[model samples]
Target: MLRMLFHPKSLKFLACIALAALTFSSSCKTVESSSGSLSEKSRTKTDVFFAEMYKKYNPYPIQDDPETPDDCQSLFKEADPSVPYKGVVVYFHGFTACPQQFYEFAQIMAKKGYSALAVLMPGQGRFPAPFNNDGKKTINGRKYKDYYSEYLPVKKGDDWKRYLNFVSDVNTFAATLPGEKLVTGLSVGGQLAAYAYVERPGLYKRALLISSYLGMPGSYSGRNSTTSGGMLNSLRRLSGDTIYHITKAVSQQGSNLDIIADREVSWGDKCYQQTRGFNGNPGRRGICDFHVENIAAINSLGEYILGQIKASPALTQIPQIQYVGPEWDTGGDTLLVRKAIGYQKARFGDDKVNACFFPNVVPHSMFARKDIAVLPETPWINSFMLETTKFLETGATYKVSQEPSEETQWDGASDQDSGVFQNRCDVYAVDYSKVSP
Candidate 1:
């Protein structure tokens, strides 16, 4: 049958050829389903996006040396039984970021009563095989020249699928940890965390998304609208066939789950002040600094996370929600998670589903005050780990989410984007005393 060669390992082009042959042999099949909510829509978008991406972007195996350092299992902490240990803190590295990048946070969480797990994803941990070229640095076996562009491998719509599979994988790993686990993603990992919250809710107690783009869903631009229209038409024309192929692929782990960067990014600030350059303001931070900022990403991440909590399957309201970023005490990441926990307690108290947003926190410091680039640190990170540990142990609650009109978000030195920041809420915390019945 023409469908014979159509498999994941079926190297894209060959599948096209196989589909071509099948055209002569059988009738077409199409897929159908019901959906609503951000998660479902995001998944739908991701699937369509990846399918299109695979057609354009080829996934070649890259070279990676799978080395497990002795420091792998170094992070661990005792879960407080007084309160349920929702989950451990698992750190995922960004592109080319090895376990080293997260050592500070990971070790701190472990000491703070969390069983921390830090692993690499894709080009992160180990290079994919297909070796050649003296083993220096290469992707798909070429000397690593244009890494961010070529190897990073992202497409416009893959956000959802990438998130879904990633959470599934993280959960599988969490199951093996000392206790339940929460996710703390950085940069690209943070983006994955946002999508994962939508794709897989309740998998973690709460998530900390740092320096990520948790933008809005749905296509708005004329180009995306038009492309989406064509896709709909194509799906209609080859409904039967498309269904068969997609269903089969989805059955096999959503093979089309690759994320590609949007040539023209749509939602979120195209570029923040820091993202552009240092500009010379005390409040003004840069992309490199924010990448290490927890709160900035959290505010954006919180918007989407609130969606995840609202859309939760079990509707298990968490005791707390936290996002730590810069613009806090001394421009450090003093935007504690405790505040968000308090907020969740106030609004949807006792449901246990808590979500909070902290601002960007600068870790120690890297360069001169102006040119200084921020990264995560261990000593300062210990606080978050301790708070999380305490939350798990004491089941403490907090209140942070106050009425938006009541608070002035841009009052101080904020580099907030319009509609995104300007209008914000007065702060409150969660009430830990109330737990779900």
Candidate 2:
């Protein structure tokens, strides 16, 4: 029995366990040392201000992880700490993405005299300890984990509150800084920024929403594209208690163990990249995989905000929002964002909402370095940033494109009657009444 217990296979298993233990121990010590040095080297006013919020929100004790580099973590750029800050621009990144998405814009804003902050949302970044059944799950007697990335801690039930609370915390942090507080975001982050502006009337000085996820795409849902609120309307009417209980129970799960097993059946394939990496954002640092249930939770938050907007009697504050995106987002985001903008316009007047949808050249989330690669025909990215920076500073209206060439000869053509790169590269004059529900 003793010889059998110490068989070759058993010894090999023990050896593997020993090696893993040693590696984990070394990793811990390295993390501790690196964290100490980082704190001493670059602790700033922004870091000091957000320390409390980090403690309050982040599940893991440490901020940086081996998987998540310092550049991709919560970022703040204040060009001159000694000099007074003119204003602050708060950035919220898209779902499954980190603060790095807005790093370039934040740095630009900082150099332009306004301080900028890109927040790291909760359940993002790598956790210190192993989680989600240690990234393995058993399905039909077989076990597997996502090959591309590890399982993130974002859950289906409480993520709604977590996301909202993150917004609230960021707002509170921004309130402490000097000058005007401007908000901007991309995708789901865009929705959060809009929610913040709507919920806290007169709080933000201006807002920019890029490729905002206002509704589910037909390709993903296997149904017609519908606004988040509309989707909730159907789920509330049809799913009733069953859906509610399932979501609630899933939320209560301590780990993503069950979600891992259900991935193939419910969530479908995990998207590794949004664009084909040729002319669009060539790379991303955020999680490539997500649970569909968590997406539902995000949509619910959007739905709640839409309900609030529709029910409000009147809009307050200055007309200071710019919506920018690609011309024809097949995911149906553009149309729904247009509709949301329409609703706000009907309620708040035309001057409150502004938009610019680039023609065929650009793609979704068109901000990364590679996405904006300086090609002969695509010098518009730099122009877009310059104009955006100008708008943030002076509240002047701006477009994503430069003046159309004589060859294009297009001037404010309708979406239908437009050629490639000529689809209203100017102020979007959307008729609020015609924008369907």
Candidate 3:
């Protein structure tokens, strides 16, 4: 009877039971796992910082925005503080978008035993309003019916400084947590993530960039004109200047065409219609309109990152980096995608950096919502999340060399073109041959 009790199978069974109990106890100890709260000191500091910054910039009544919370303009801490975290991701949303853009992604990270903090960029996440810099009018000066007509109070250099400070503060808080540190962003946020990784070498273990707004593709000249003109309109408002120079140039060409009309032609129609949220409903939020000032800021930030890459080639030090670009993204250009991949390859070598393109995905805000379905040919968000976690935990790299066939390309291919589409998306990887400097 003693020999039977001490059998190998019996010992193995007992070990399994013990492990299960240990896991259960650890999970039970986690408090506020879904909505992790920051310490009192951190919250106070965040509030004070934003309060002072808003006053300096044209103060928009951010508290009044229906979408924003009264206490904070951002969401932070998505994991249990008491439990040991697997990793921490500092996620930044896209230009003109709120922290809600990263809400679903943060939830996924928390579920996977990681912590996530989604930081709201300066002057974003609030109701769009035009500001008068002279202080003659209220911060929420005029309420316009159309979003395009609204102007954001953006001090170019000052705003970027505030953004950098916010990112640094969040990084400092993330350091207190017991886990690896990671940074990720979308579009302009992607540019900021790259900037953060470059600025602080060895601080972030991994970085993920989605459709960084480095620059538009060469073929998007027409679209670029409309976007650039719109951005200039916002700048004109804050500077209290007119587009007289541009108007004069157009007049000198022997045409009586209205320059302002030409700039406003594609005001609210530039971005592709998102499939989810208020923007999806034509009667509700209409289309996801791009803010003029926000676009300008994004372009400026992208330029800064490129300049940094050129200035300090050897300072890039993140261990693992992954860049995801959409094959059909209308908001960000494909040329910018190649530039992002090339920059990483140049700095971190081919082994540490990886890139992938979603075959039919077009929306710039691809991963904004959790319920939205991924392109049938691309891997699901869960797969991406798992892979991200794996990289953060083990520094594992997934490199795919399989060349996509012509049928796999997005050139009007039918859904039934190949069996590869039917199978689960292989691990996300970067194909170096596809990228060009």
Candidate 4:
């Protein structure tokens, strides 16, 4: 009787009811400024358009920190006003990252005669409020309970739907630009770019997905810690649930997943130039510490997209795709990314799908800043930008190569062996010999 009563469908319905109740209760207690809607405005009027964008997307004040860096905000780079732009290029930064992550690249694209917009992802670029039992307090002119935090300000399912909707909005805005549309994104942003392309076939002329988030490895060498993916996926398969039940089991009632809520954020400069104290960076821009629920949400999107690709016989309508996989990526499951791309290549052939794998020394946030990426001797970043420009123009990939590190090894069978042990080798061996950079 209990099993029948608590059937998966029943449980989901109950969860929805519970969530709705929580929402109603919280809305009564929480005070927040409305994220104003963008009125249909002329894109040519840059100031009006951007002001509306800021109001709509980044409305919440950074609690206790009034000033936010310009780089961290949604940014737009225009080509020479005199010259007609070839197209518009949209860039999405990694999860927890600000638009600053792609500012430089956006500028590059702009210089190459493409209007570039680096969009700030939802729930980013705002600082979280300090923990408090009562969900009401004013801090830095914003309601504390309304702010995003691990201690629970607000959460709705995996939050993938919100993200997808945001993507659609951004693309719709970009569609108004003067020319053909192109997009590039890193990490979770890369996954969103894929979603944008897949959701609206032929909407983009080309897509560049770099280190797309699919899954995380069991451990991270940088953090010297085991990740939740290993344990979470194990539970997911066992429970045959979409990760929600496992989150519910681990988290307290009303908080689906806050396993690392108490863990002190130790991002220290990886997130920004400084980390003085607990939420004390006066100019802090992006989220440094996020809930495990965030990870589960992103992974769910990845799984859904992968399933969509697998289910389709052929995605012929989608334009050319350029996939950039890091040889050594700790942020996401590179193996899964490669496997998914392999599926696409098999279905559409080599002409439609292209991939490039960077070396092991490079960090997952390689494109963010020079200080962040422990780069090779080669000017790989510059070469990469040039290659991207070439691709946008001609749908061609340039050859970039150097001998693999002596310590690199590829003797592996399992995904783990192939992922961590391959040591940055391009396992799929997408031929890069066709053109020299």
Candidate 5:
């Protein structure tokens, strides 16, 4: 028996157990309290949460990769501590996107005497190489080459817990800030923002959701090909460590890196060509990566929000809300926006809800700097900033104008007539119950 126990296979098994123990021990350090201001306490909690999360999922220290940009890092823009400013705006960026998505908006807020902190979502704002461990050696094997770069290595249930913890900590910090508290988010961030609002009604004075992803559009769901693949991947990850590693290695061996890179570049170019006001530079566009597990996590959150709205038809203390939707958004159904507005109004009176739809302009990333409307005739960015300031200051709502068509020439436009731009804005009136799933 002793001789059998000393076999090479047994030794390898022992080593794996030892490794797992070490990983767990290192990742589960006690969070220490630090001496600082009240705001610093909130920051400390956030830092500690991420530290444990990174240790568990990404055991290796992050290497200094030249490919990563500074803007891709998380940001906390503090207002003048001396002056009593209006308050803080806690901004959350979309899925796979970095804090840079809201960095400009934060700056605009800062300039207007309001502090802004753009919280980086868990598993975001990192170099893409860390997540390329799917064991693909070629582009053909990787169906999502163009959009798979810099994605988070999310392992189902654990990832969602980490994300919720992040949201909680950030909101706690927002409470410490002076003046009024405002929360804003885009895409998945929007979903999280809605969760934050619903979870802590009185916490935020106002909330703005841009292209909130309540549900997948019918067209998008029909076109999706990775549902089965994602299910299989989730199963593999849930399997024991030995089996998971073996399966991952087998999958990675067949991929071609050069082909993957070429495809990524080609896709990026196409996106630039199609998008108006898009900076020609590569990688400047917000993350195009998609992870099925992440999508499922966001969807779960959305479902929870809907359920909560249904359970308590009237919320105790709902904040003033602005629901901004894009007519051309492909990620989420426009009808869901209508549904959300309807639910909010039903729960918290019609006067509490406001809705705006930008027609013939912008995608799901409506509030992102890259997607901000910048037609030559319309300084949409400035107007949006002013409107945001007004909303935050007095809870005032602006109706989307139905202006006549103007012949505006966009970048790379042909002589063909580009139709007029229409703005659809209204108070919540639709009966959400009547809408189909």
Candidate 6:
């Protein structure tokens, strides 16, 4: 495996993963190859993005057990500061996610003429864990207690500290640079951006949150409320005596051993609602389902976090939010985002809260619904780049209501279970001059 991808060879590295199962989506779609080899690109040849070089930082040896670093700073492991940005981008990853996964998003921002900095939050990287398949027989599978990267559910109130430091660190890093500094986050990263926007206002000029939620109250489901005792994992190789940290590992079991409430409404339900499986796994369907919390937790977390953000003291309390997504996302996250719109220090929707609802299918979700006008499928991986860079420059307005156009199947409505949706919304224009001058 090391021979396969020790260095960043975009083309050949993809081929190597193809030989192995590069687990992705249920849709079996082909991700476009990144145009060039980053190997030739001038990165400081740093092995791991962050948290490596354990020996240099700590005087005493560190143990993986309930791992805690004494000197862990309030900031992130930054890239070379000498690398300037015409525009600054501070990025965050999602649940059970790795900073490496946002390569597509980062590349997109870079291509859009921005200096992109992505952060890997604590409890989200390579933490050693044992596989949970205590099976009957070991068919050449020597039954040894082995370790793998799995989702170590964040203990209650723990994620906030990590995110707070991450946001502050990103802000400090971006402040020293020049150009339009924008904060963008995917999945949970979006949440971080919102928090940072509120807490450390004016630090980021704009926020691009993809597949994230805004403030809302939660609907609880009866379930375990325990501090999940597992390790956050990364997808690295298990070398002879030590486990190598490659990509981050996600959990198969933990406090989230089962699906969220409701068999139909939740994103997890929608993921499994599909007839086809993704990346060969039937369960890993839609965006919401993949390692998501219950709706209540989602709402509570959003409210708790974004509320703190909204209440925070920023230079211009309200940083404009450009909400973008397909119908499914529009109805799901936008509803909560609308609530968040009002909480911003700036007046809500005074061109400060922009929305764009795509009348297309979001690629990261289950494909079980009608996607007659699904946007070009190829742009899945690269959409973040385009969307983020484009939005910061334009800051245009968009809103798509669920109301069907004249071309509706039955007076612009379907009898089948279409789930919740939005129509009659608009797409943000590609170009907008001075923002709220």
Model 2's alpha-carbon lDDT is: 0.53
CA shift at 275, candidate 2, in angstroms?
Answer: 14
**Model 2: which ten-residue window has the lowest total lDDT?**
25-34
In terms of TM-score, how similar is model 6 to the real structure?
0.51
lDDT per residue (tens digit) for residues 1-437 in model 6: 12223444435434423422332111111111133332322222222222232212211111111111111111122222334335756766554333444443444455445655554444343321111223321213522111111122232344325445556655665576557777766556677777767667666777766656442211111111242532211111112111111000111121332332211122222222221223322121112221222223334446567656455444356566765544334223444554454454254534566544444344322121111113334333233334455576555444344554211222223233222222334433332221111
Task: Go through the candidates in order and give each one's C-alpha lDDT.
Answer: 0.34, 0.53, 0.47, 0.54, 0.51, 0.38
Query: How many backbone clashes does every candidate have?
Result: 64, 0, 0, 0, 9, 24
Q: Best by lDDT, which number? A: 4
Task: Estimate the lDDT of model 3.
Answer: 0.47
Q: Assess every candidate by TM-score.
A: 0.41, 0.62, 0.60, 0.66, 0.61, 0.51
lDDT of 1 by residue, 51-112 (tens): 33222222332111112111111122333334433446766544333334454454334434
Q: Write the per-residue lDDT of candidate 2 for residues 1-437, one digit (tens) a residue.
A: 12323555445434433433443211111111211333443345455545554444543332233322332357666544444457878888876666767767765666556767777666553322111232343322443223212233344445466777778778877787678889888878888888777667777888988777765432121112223422222223333445444543443452454644234212112222221133332333444444535545565666666666656644465338887765544322354565676677777777877777665355455665532333334444555666667677677776534654221342232242223232244433433222111
- How many angstroms is residue 214 displaced in model 3 relative to the true structure, after the best TM-score fit? 1.0
Cα lDDT of model 4 by residue, 64-156, tens digit: 222222334466666645545588788888876667677666655655567777766766655332332233334456443233443222233
Off by over 4 Å in 5: 1-70, 81-83, 128-162, 219-286, 312-315, 371-379, 402-437
Candidate 5 vs candidate 6, lDDT winner: 5
Q: Give the number of the best model, judged by TM-score.
A: 4
lDDT minimum window of 10 residues, candidate 4: 25-34
Task: Give per-residue lDDT, candidate 5, residue 340.
Answer: 69
Model 5 over residues 1-437: C-alpha lDDT tens digits?
Answer: 22223554455434433543565211111121112233756556555544554454334322111222224444556654444567788888887565667766665566455676665566553332212223342334554433343335333444445556667777776676667888888887888788787767699989988778765442211121223531122222232334333323322331222222222211233233322123422233234444344444555566566676556544577788887765535556444555667666776787788766655344456545443334333324445545655676567775566542111212113232223232464322333222111
Q: What is the Cα-based lDDT of residue 249 in candidate 6?
A: 12
Candidate 3 lDDT over residue span 153-244, tens digit each:
22234454555665666666557656678888887778778877777778788888876766432232112222333222222332223333
Candidate 6 stretches with Cα past 4 Å from truth are 1-85, 127-160, 214-300, 309-316, 330-334, 345-349, 363-387, 394-437
lDDT score for residue 25 of model 4: 13
